[model samples]
Target: MSHADPDQLTLVALGEPAADRSTSDHVRGCAACRAELASLREVVALGRESHVELDLPMPSEAVWDRITAEVDRKNTTVVAVPPHRPRRRVRGLLAVAAAAAVIGAASAVVVDRAATSTPVAAEQLLARAQLSRLGTAPGGARGTVRVVRTGDHAVMRVAVDGMPAPQGLYQVWLYDGVDTMIPLGVLTGGEVEVPVPAKVDLTRFKVVDVSAQRLGQQEHGVSVLRGELG
Candidate 1:
């Protein structure tokens, strides 16, 4: 009858086992706990779905080992110090704490940068298009596409909604304003990134097309979503 612990509910939402039967029963019966669990699940799903791979710099093992050794030495020295030198001991402890904090902050900075570096670099928007429904698609599906040129590579991010599942798979294509219709990649729905070839000229291939392609089809399929990159 009691409410579930927030920590236990979080763990359960994250696919971890609940702490106890009481927590499990509370989560099942309590509307508030169920809502919180659903919200946490959505957040976890978004985190997993929106993950972008980034090129991150790794700290060397020797650097970590040295930090560990230094901390160990400081701890040992602190403990061995006599009570007569209380002021000196306090100063030493404070210095060690400060060093640890600095190291932790630096490590956190590196990790945060590595996680967010890709999106920042890829945010140089080159072109954008509002994808409109084409042909006799059942739903009033709408989407937006953004093309970004990061360094030598170009990336296209697409977000679509109200799209009913196709018979086969949805594939993205790029047209080079001529006879060439280059296939970028397959789309899984919601939001997806399609990598454009670095050598491909975006000026020529300005058309972004999302098509429903049948299995084993080598040619360009029916265009469901169409947009022109400006």
Candidate 2:
């Protein structure tokens, strides 16, 4: 794998690392690198303000103001790349943003539907779906995996039922079509979120599986549950 550029490094510093080789090595080595990555992540997160103007078909004067506000909030400016080339890039960004919004909203719908149902519990459904490491006693426990789509980029939340509390800690993984599972990082707790690789075709892994594990090797073990998205 090739090393990431400065921008990729900046994203990694902000808790959003591109799938580059160097950043992973740095993450394994330096504490300062991790702290810097978190700070950048929080800064990018602050730009997630919901401006009603962005909802309009054509950007209104108000929309431009909100856009500027977002850029200013991040201490960055929107670069106007060559119009022809940028069209594809801009469209891709919009698609991912739209997908993320849809996924986030769907989570609420799932909860509402569960509230009306009798069998499945919301926490259990969420855990099985989103949480990577899950273990349960010998009953029919439930869990939910909420994956939001932003273009091809996916973000997911996991909730589990009957899962034994972590002995120490565990991390999440995104399995490729092959046997290898890439580390997304340590779970934040019962509720944690992470960005899925833009390259991962969700359709291929519709029935993605989650497992509970001790953080020794990057192997999938004792999978607790699995579900299909499409």
Q: Which candidate should be chosen as best, given TM-score against the real structure?
A: 1
Indicate which candidate wins on lDDT. 1
| Cα lDDT tens digits for candidate 2, 1-230 | 33223344443433433555766786667676566556545434433433322321333343344334433444754422222322223323333333344555667779999898777323312222433333443355455667765443557776656555665454555554467666565554555677766776666655555566775755665556555554
Backbone clash count for every predicted candidate, in the order shown: 0, 27
Q: Which digits, one per residue and each the tens of the lDDT, describe model 1 over residues 1-230?
A: 45566545544554657756877787778898899778655544443332322122332444344335545763654222222322223223333333454556668889999888875454588899998899756567988999887877779999888888888888889986569899988889577998888887878888988888998888999988888999
Q: Residue 28 in candidate 1 has what lDDT?
A: 78
Off by over 4 Å in 1: 1-122
Residue pairs clashing in model 1 are none
Q: Please list the C-alpha lDDT of all candidates, in the order they appear.
A: 0.68, 0.50
TM-score for each predicted model, relative to the true structure:
0.49, 0.36
